[model samples]
Target: MKSFDVAIIGSGPAGASAAFELSKSGISTVIIEKETLPRYKTCGGGFVFRGRKNMPFDIASVVEKEFHSIDTYFSKKHPHLTTTRDQPIITMVMRDAFDNLIVEKAKENGVTLLQNHKVENITFGDTQILHTTEGDIEAKFIIAADGALSPIAKIAGWKETRTIIPALEYEIEVPKADFERLSQNVRFDIDAIPYGYGWCFPKKNHLSVGVGVFTKTNKKINLKEHYATYLQTLGITEILSEAAHGFVIPVTPRTDIFVQKNVFLTGDAAGLADPLVAEGISNAILSGVQAAQAIIESNLDSEKAAALYTAKLEETILPEIRIGAKLSYHFYHQSTFRNIVLKKYGQFVAEAMTDLFMGERTYPADYKASVTRKIKEAIF
Candidate 1:
């Protein structure tokens, strides 16, 4: 068996981030990916500024477009609201290029990457043994960044407690006229779907349009039909072949545990997507870096590493997600609540969100107390 200090499953943002951080620390690490390098990934491809600011290196080479403002609407005909920032609030990139860039950076930092190698089974003993289609390997520690339906997490018995939500995306090649009109700004229509939202993100030559839903809700809605309606609303009549893809987004962290012995679950595997925006890239990178940090801090001690990771999650990511979950529950569940907030304080709320995404402010830390107070005042 080929042995290494750390082995990461998946080569997405979370896995690549962990590999980069581990390689920088001189740890022997390898990434095993199920797909070939630069393979297509289904996502809106909107990289929020907060995530960009947290990246260790510049991503200008991969950024397709940067937007300074966002246009939000309750519906197609509703009076839209705009939020602006002096700096770009969001940078868009195709996931194939963006993910590959991160992985290449990790390789530059001396991390080994095994592409098109699917891990079939994993055994836990003194060290974790990963049996892959290519071969077998042993690792002192495992970081599962394999995403929403992480097989590694399931084998390690960590996935059952997580909350997974359904999401669908389309890479639409609209007419130049439609593209120009739609690409004027990043758009989000909240009332396009119940318990979720629809977004139009402009890339270099195309638009990434999609709708997602929080499956935990009891509402039965056809997401595909809704996506079609969304495109029609944007006046996009043609969609390229193989442009539609469906995936799941993890909305809440695993409540039971984030770490099990030598295995650490990061990113969507750990259910780290933001509840409010359904954004996962930022939290994925953060958790990946934190996981690497925990291992480094513990000197490869499994128990200590797991404990440290859990503590770091509590200190940083979990609190915000918890508050976000509460906020989403209230905002999506009650139309009356939404109306009250939008009618009375929509502009302030939109500006606060823009500031949060721009890294100038943080949720729960900067607005939780005030938001709670305002909501109470509005309701009462």
Candidate 2:
């Protein structure tokens, strides 16, 4: 059995960020990954400024593309709104490269990394013991940075409520001549794709386009059929290489109790994903950093660590998730309301959500004080 101060399961942005912070704090941290470095994660590969702000190191060298313009389209209203900012508000990068870069940085900072090790079972008592395929390992504390369907969370008997948003993403190779048109805007459309929206994010030589919808009342709409139909309508038939993938995005927030004795949970494992846009990259990274800080600040006190971690989340991320959940409900439930708002202040809406993603603004309170106030005033 091996011993460490912290053992992190999963090597996504959340796990990597936690390990990085732990390494900087001079804690004996180890990151165990079930897959090899640069392993492919099924993601849209979009990075909002929220995660970028929390990064302690420079990521300029690894940034694939920095976007300043966000184009939003409401299919029902037939309105298109474009929001532009002075600086890079959102970024696009390959998840494999981006996640690997952070983990590699953590490794450089003296964090031990174990690859191809899958954590099978975790027991929490005097000291948390992790049973992995590699072997048994003990740690003073455990951070379940594992993903939405985290096995560790299940083993620890953590209750996570999930509202799965089904998404189908495809990376298609586009020709050089057509690259400019596709790369110009990161497009998001509502109404045209029922229950959810279609997004086109530009990559180096390919385009990542996908449609996602809430899975509350399971509809038999075929994602691939819609994706194909949309692409054909857009006249993007050029094909070089393609990879089709599907994944679930959790819209629910964390349960009331996120900490159990010596174990901590964050990221999708704890259901910290935003409800509106289904964005989790930044949320996951932020959760990981907060979880690590809570652990260190508690002085190895599990109760304090859990409380602080939950507090930080409520203070920072929960508000956004709450607003997002409300927005998600509105967007899916009431198309008339969605179209009215989009037609009125589509650009403002995009920028405000972008602001949250960029860490410039937070949730619920901000919404109550701003839009809700404006809406109330306008109504009266």
Candidate 3:
């Protein structure tokens, strides 16, 4: 058995960030991960500049593409609108590479990583103990940075509600000419299939074309077929490859009670992904930082420290996600109304949408306020 001041389950961004913060405070911290480092992870891999503003270390080395404009389409609706931004709005990278970069940083900061450790069970005595494949380890505090199906949060009996959204993605090697054209812009098609969106995100040598549908029943829409249709719509007929994968993602707003007793939860395990865009990398890292701060600020009362962390999230992040959920609902259902707004508002609408997408603004409260104000002014 090995003992540490803090133990983190899951070596994603949340866990790595928490470990980096804790280890820098001279606290003995250990990270347990079920999979080997640099595991294959499917994601949009789009990180906005706003999300990277406060990172603990430099991230330029891992960025695959930095996009300056966003083109949103409404294919399911009658009218379509495209929005563009003159400035860079999103930084795209591979999830495996980005996560590995952070974990390596945590290691460099003196955090011990227990690779290939699957947590069997976690129990809390005077101190917290984690039973894993390797052995048992004790810690004064534990953070569950695991993911949506966090074993640590479940072991602590922390209640959480997760709403699943089916997402299918692909890493396609497009023709050189197609790649050259896509490199200048990032394209998105709303309701491209149904109840979801399709995207063409450009990288160094390839384009990520994918779709996410909000269907409860697994009717099983052929993602590859849908991708082909989308490419045809874009006037693309080149078939380079058909490599693809599908996964489920939770979309509801996450809670602040992620921290409980001797345990705390972060990232997907804590259900922190934004319901609107399903973007979570930045949120994961932010939550990890807050978790570490809570531990370092913990004196005689750990509850107070946890409460502080929850407060910061509620005050800063939760409100935005809540609004994102509402806006996402409208975007999925009210395509006509969205098209009207986009065509009418054009750039203003585009910039605002970009702001919300980039985490620079929250659509939940501000969006409602805008609607109410418009109604009062009889604009609608």
Best by TM-score: 1
The TM-score ranking, best first, is 1, 2, 3
Residues 1-380, model 1: lDDT tens digits: 78899999999999999999999889999999999999998888888998998899999999999999899988533478999888889999888999999999999989999988899998898988999999999998999999989999889876487667887888878777888999989999886878888999998998888999863686777999999888877788866543888998888888898888588999999999988888889999999999999999999888889999999999988998988877777677776767776767888888988987887776765455676677787888
Worst 10 residues of 1 by lDDT: 363-372
Error of 3 at 43 (Å): 1.1
lDDT of candidate model 2 versus the reference: 0.81
For all predictions, the C-alpha RMSD in Å is 1.9, 2.2, 2.8
Q: Rank candidates by lDDT, best first.
A: 1, 2, 3
Supply the TM-score for candidate 2: 0.93
TM-score of candidate 3 to 2 decimals: 0.90
Using all chains and alpha carbons, the TM-scores for the candidates as numbered come to 0.95, 0.93, 0.90
lDDT winner between candidates 1 and 3? 1
CA lDDT scores, all candidates in order: 0.87, 0.81, 0.77
